[model samples]
Target: MQRILEALGWRQGSFVKPETVAKLIGDIDSTFTISANNLLVVASQSCDVASSQEEYIELSIVRPLSAEAFNKQYSHNRHPRILHIEANSNSSDEKVILELKAHEKIQIKKSLLEEFKPDSSINFLEGNLNQYIDWLAGRYKRPALPTKFDQLIASSDKKGKRKKIAKRANEYLTGIYVDIYPNRDIKDEETYSVNLLGIASNDQSIASATDALNEYADILKDAGMDVSVPKVGTEFKISVGTLRQYQRINFDYLSYEENNPIPPDTGI
Candidate 1:
C-alpha cells in the first residue's frame, strides 16, 4: 500500500496543500468554488438553478495524504448532492457518490446513483470527475529515478572492487565553479579566459570538462559573441601601483597565473 501510494506521487512526509487542491480543481473547471475545505462543483447547465444545485466534494488532508478521509466521510451518510441532468428535454434525478479507500492499496470510486435514467447525460459529469481524479493521481505521483546512471554506479559496488560506482556518482553530484575573465593586455577584443575549478584531476574528467567548455564557447560564438577556444595556463599581469609610480607594480598580488582575471573589453 505504501509503495502504491508512493508510485502515485504521494510521499509519506508530504501534505497536499490547499492551494494545490484549488489549482487542480481550477484546471478542471475554473468556475468551481472552493468554500472552506469543500469543493462545490455545479453539474447543471441552468443558470437559475446553478446556485442551489451543486455537487459538494469534501477534501481533507491526512498525515500521508491518503484516502482515509473519504472512507470515514462516506461510512456514515452517502447522500450529499442530487445531480439533475437534462436529457432530450427530460429532467432526471441522480445522486453523486464518491468513495476512496485503501484495502491492499488506495482506490478511488466516483459515480452517479443507481437511479440514472436511460437517456441521462450524467456521463459528461462523470467523465469530468474522472479526469480530475487522473490529475490528482498525477499530482501525487512519485518522481522518476535516474535508472541508467544508478545502474552504472551500482555495478561497480562489488566486494574487493575499488568502489568505482561511488566515485562515478560523486563526479555527477559535485558542482563545478567557473571564473570568466577578459584578456585586458591582449590587443584582440575577442580574447577571454574561462577558469574552471572543482573538476576532478583525472585525465578523463579534465577532457570532459574541456569538451563541455568548448561547447559552451561555441554556443556563445554562435550568439554573435566573439569567444575563442580556451587555452590552459595563460598568464596576465595587473598594475597595482599609483599613477605617479607605474614602475612600482605589485605583480605578486595581481598575477593572472595565481588568480582569474577579467578582460577589460567584456564590460563585466
Candidate 2:
C-alpha cells in the first residue's frame, strides 16, 4: 500500500485541472471559486511540499497565453510578469503557448492534496522544474535597477529592431555574461559602457549567433551605448568604478532549454 501523501503528486511542476480542485479541496470554501479555469501547479520547493512542515502548499495558476503574447517570441518568456510553458511540456495536445502568472499563486491545504488521485494530475517536464522554480522565486528576486537605467534599456523597443534581433539571438545563443562600466549605480545624465559575453548553443549555431550578435551590437550603438561582446570563455576585467549586472539588461528575451542551464542577459 502506498503512503497517503506518497500516492499524491505534490512535487513541483505537478499540475491539476480546475475540475480537480473541487474534488480535492471541496467547495466548502472559496478556493475552488478563486481557482476556476486555472491549471494548478505546485510552486513551493518540492522538499518543502514533501515535508510535514506546513499546512498549505503553494501553487501557481496557469492560463492560456493571450494572442499578443503568443505571437511575440520573447514577451511570453523569461518575463517577470509571467512564464511561458509550451503545451507539449504540459501534456496538452496543441502546440500552443501557456502563461503562468506569478501574482496569481494560491496556497491549498496539504491535507486535501494528499487525498487527490495521483494519476489524474498532469505534470510539467522534470527538466523544466528548475526554471519554473527560479521564475517563481524571481518574482521577488528581480533586480532593482535605477529607474532611468532600466528605461534606457527598455528604450530599444522604439528602434523596432529588438524583436528581430531577440528572435534571432535567442534561437542561436546558449549562455551570456555582462559587465557594466563605472560599476556603480548609474545616473540618468551619463552614458555607460557595456560588455556582453555570449556562448553559442552549439556548433551549428555559431555562425547564426555571430550574425545575431553583430546586429545586437548595432542595436546597442544606436541606443548611444558603447558595447563589446567577447567570444565564449574569454576573460575580461571588472575594474574599479565598475560592476557586473545580471537580470538588468541584454538578451532578457531569450528563453532557456535543457541543453543550456546558464540564463542569458535581459533585453538590451
Candidate 3:
C-alpha cells in the first residue's frame, strides 16, 4: 500500500499545470480551461499540505492579469471574492488573479494528489503567501457595516458635491473608517455622533483622504447624526490614545461598489 504520509511536490500556495488541476477537480462545471498564460493555484494551507491528517486539497482557477487590469479594473473591486497574485510574487514574468467561485473549489483527495507531483510548484513571493492565507480566513470573519451607515453610503451619489466626495473617497482614498458613537441598539430615526478617519498610503493621498472625509461629513449632516472629520494634514491624527476610536470602514459600504450600487452600471 502507498504510504499515508508520503511527501508531495505541492505546497500551500503552489501553482501547477492545467492537467494537474483537471485531475483534482472531481466533477464541477468550473472554468477549468487554462490559457497559455494561466495556471492552477493551490489554496490549501501549508500546514495542511504538510500534515497527513488532512484528506483533501483545494485550488482556485487563475488567469493572467495585466498590470493595467490590476490597476484600473479589478483593483477597484476589492471584494473578498476577488484576489490578485502579483507578478513579483513568483519567478514567472506574468501576474495572475484568482477566479473564486461560491465554494465551488477544485478539490481533490490527498491520496490522489500523491499520485503525482508538479514539475515545480510556484508560491507567492516573500511573506505574501502568509498574507494570502490570512486574507482567505479574514473574508469570513469580516464585520458588517451598520445598516444605517450602508444607507448613508448608498445615498452619497444622489447629487452635487456628494458624487465628488464619494468618488474621491472611494476611488482615491479607498477607505473611510468611522467610529459612530452609540451605534449599538440604535432605534429607527435615532441620532448618533460619527467620528471619521480616512486611510491612505501616502502624504498627498492622506491630504486628499482628509478632505474626502470632511466632504463625507457634509453627506452625513443629513444622515441623522453629528459628524466630525479630521482636518487635512501631512500626518494622521488620532484621538488622545484610543485605537478603538478609528475603525476602518468596510469597503462594501462604499457607494462605488457593486454590493452597494447607486445605479447598477447602466452600460453607458
Candidate 4:
C-alpha cells in the first residue's frame, strides 16, 4: 500500500491541506484511522472529525497542493493529529520518504500540483488499462519517434548573436518490451524480453516523448529492470524511403495478438 501511495505522492507525517480539496481534484478517497499504539488520530477530510468512527484507525488525504489555512480556520474544535505525507505521482519506493514530526505544517504551492501531472497520465492509462497496456506490450512494441522535430528547430532563433543555441538530442524510452524471447529452456527463461531503446526525432516530439518516457522509465527501474538507452548512430537511423513507408497503426483485436507475436495470431 505504501508503494502505491508513494506512487500517488503521499509519505508519512505530511499534512494534507484543504484536506478534501486534494481528493476533489485528484479523484482519491478519504478515510479515518487511529494508531494502535499511541491512539493518535489520523484524519483525511476537509477539516477534522471525532474518534466516533474509530480510535485506532488513521486517515490521510493526498492532493496536488495543501490548503492548511483553509482547513485550520474551518476545522472548528475537531482537529485530529493531522499529518501530511509529501509525495505525489513522482514518488517510487526507491525515493525515500522524508520523516516529519507530529503536527508539522505541510507546505502547499501551485507548482507542486503541476509537478504531479504525470500521475494523471497514469490515471489516464488506468481508464483504458486493458487496452493501452496490451497495445504497448504488443502492437506498439517497436518504438518510433514522432515527425514533429524539425518544426521546433526551424522556429528557434538560428541567427543573431546566439542568445540560446538549439541543438539536437536523442530521447530514449526504456520499458519491458514483454515479447517472447528465444530460449531453448522454456521453464527457466520463459516468454518475453525486456528491451530498452533510444529514439531520435525532431526536437518538439522529443520534448513530449522525454516527459512521457521518463515517467515510465522510473516505474521500470523500480521494478528491477536493467534499462538502457538504445544505440543512436547504429541501431536507429532515418531514411527518406523509410519515412514514406512508415505508418503508425492502431493495435487492437484485428491488429496484434495477446502475446505480441509478430505477424499476429499468437495469443497468451
Candidate 5:
C-alpha cells in the first residue's frame, strides 16, 4: 500500500480518470456502513496475496478515513486516496471468468480459463485502482465552458463598476510580476488567479480593445474566465515589485525594454 501510494504522485494519468471519481461516489452512496468482511475483501483484492497475515486491519478503522468525506477534503476532485484489496474466497467453481463489458455488451470477449490456463490457487486482479483515481481527478477537476456567448457575461451589472475595473487592472498588471503556471484544460479554476501581463491594440475602438482582450482571453480561457473589453480608452500603469516566491504570471507574448533583463522560469 505504501508503494502504491508512492507511485501515484501529483500528476494525472489514464487510470486516474473520471470513472474513479464516479466509483468513489458510488461506493459512498451504496453503503452507509461498510461491513468488516467487505473491508477485508477490499484489502485482500488490492495487494498480491502471497499468504494470509493474522493481523489484518479492521474495516471500521479503514472505511471512515478511506470514505468520500476524507476524499472530498484531501483528494482533489473527490478522488480515492487509499487503495486496498478485497478478497472473496467462497466461490466453489474451478474456473474464474473475467468479463470486459461496454454498456452491458461484451466489448472484447475473453475468459480467464481460455486466455490463460486456469490455476485455481491464483486470483486474477480486476482493475488498476491507482490509475483510475488519477484519471478521475484529471477529468472532473476541469469543467467544460458554456456553449453560448451570453453565458460568459457577468450576471451582475455592478461587475463593471469602477472599483471592479481598478481591481481587474491591478490583476492584469500584477501578472507581469508573478510566475505563471501551465494549464491542463480551458475550464481550470487556478487559471483565473493569473493576470494578463500586457495588451496590444490594432485599432482605437472598444471593439479593437475587445479583440485584443479576446486574444488574452484565449490564453486564459483554459485557465478560467472569458475575455471582454473594458469600456473604450481604458489604460492603466503600474511599477512591478519583486515577485513573490512560487507565484506565477503568464503572457501571450512579451517584449523587454532596451537594457532590461528577462526573468527566469521557475518550472514549478
Candidate 6:
C-alpha cells in the first residue's frame, strides 16, 4: 500500500502538516483523527503557478476494512462504493472517501476469472491482477497535476499547447500490478508479473504511450522510489476491448432512451 501511494506521488509522513490540514478543512482546535490502521500522506498540489488560482496540496490516507465487516457488506455485491463528505454546507466542497476490504482483491480476481475464463482451452496468460486492482481503485481518485504541467495547459487556450500538456499528462502512470502465483511444495516457487497502465491521448500511438510511461517511471526512480519500467505489451487489450464494447452499448441505450418517448401505461 505504501508502494502504491508512493507511486501515486504521495510522500509518507508521521502526520499531515497542521497548516495543510487547516487549509483543507478550515481551522479546527482538534487535530485530525489518525489511527494505527491509517496514516496521512501529502500529495503535491498543482495549479496555474502564475495565475491567482489558489495553489494548495492535498493529503490522503487509506483505512483498511476488516475482513469480517467487508464480507458482510460487499461479499455478494462485489462492488466497491464511494461516498463524498461535504466539509461545508456547500455541495461543491466535498472530500473524497475510499474504502477497501481484504476480500476485495480476491473478489476482483474472481470477477476477472468470470470475465476472461482463462482456463477454458485458450492459453491466455494472466497479467498482474494486483495491478488491475490498484488501477480499479485509483481510477476513481484524481491525481494532482504537476504545477508546471498545469501552468502550461492554463497559460493559453491554444490547441497546440493543450495537446502538448495532454500528451505529457497521458504518460503519467497510475497503477502497477504484480502477479504472484504460489507453488504447491516450495515456498520460494513463484512467478512474478508486473503490468502498468498510463493515461494517454486518443491520438497517441502505442509506442509513444509506452515511451511516456517509461519516462514517468524514470522520474519516480529519480525521486528515490523503488520503481522499474516494465515492458509494455498486449496484456490489457482484452479489457480495453471489453470496456469499449460496454461503452458503445451504453451509448446506444442512452441515445435510444433520449430519442424515444415513453409509452402510456394502460391499466393492467
Per-model root-mean-square deviation over C-alphas: 24.9, 8.2, 6.1, 20.5, 19.4, 24.9
Which is better, 2 or 6, measured by TM-score?
2
lDDT of 1 by residue, 123-183 (tens): 2244434433332343233222122212222344324122222233233212222233432
Error of 1 at 161 (Å): 36
Q: Judged by lDDT relative to the true structure, which candidate is superior, 1 or 2?
A: 2
Residue 207 in model 3: lDDT:
66
| Highest-scoring model, lDDT | 2
Clashing pairs in 3: 177-249
Ordered list by lDDT, greatest first: 2, 3, 6, 1, 4, 5
lDDT of 6 at 254: 16
- lDDT at 97 for candidate 5? 22
lDDT of 5 by residue, 78-119 (tens): 212232322122355443221111111111111111222212
lDDT of candidate 3 over 29-97, digit per residue (tens): 455553434566677876777676777777666665555555422332344555554524345665444
Please, what is the whole-model Cα lDDT of each candidate in the order they appear?
0.28, 0.57, 0.55, 0.28, 0.27, 0.29
Residue 159, candidate 6: Cα error in Å is 51
* Better model by TM-score: candidate 4 vs candidate 6: 6
TM value for model 4:
0.20
Once fitted onto the true fold, the runs of candidate 6 whose alpha carbons sit more than 4 angstroms away are 1-37, 41-54, 67-242, 248-268
- Looking at candidate 6, the ten consecutive residues that score lowest on lDDT are 247-256
- Say which prediction, candidate 4 or candidate 6, comes out ahead on lDDT: 6
**Candidate 5: residue 124 Cα off by (Å):** 8.8
Residue by residue across 17-39, what tens digits does model 6's lDDT show? Answer: 33333343322222445344442
Using TM-score as the measure, the top candidate is 3
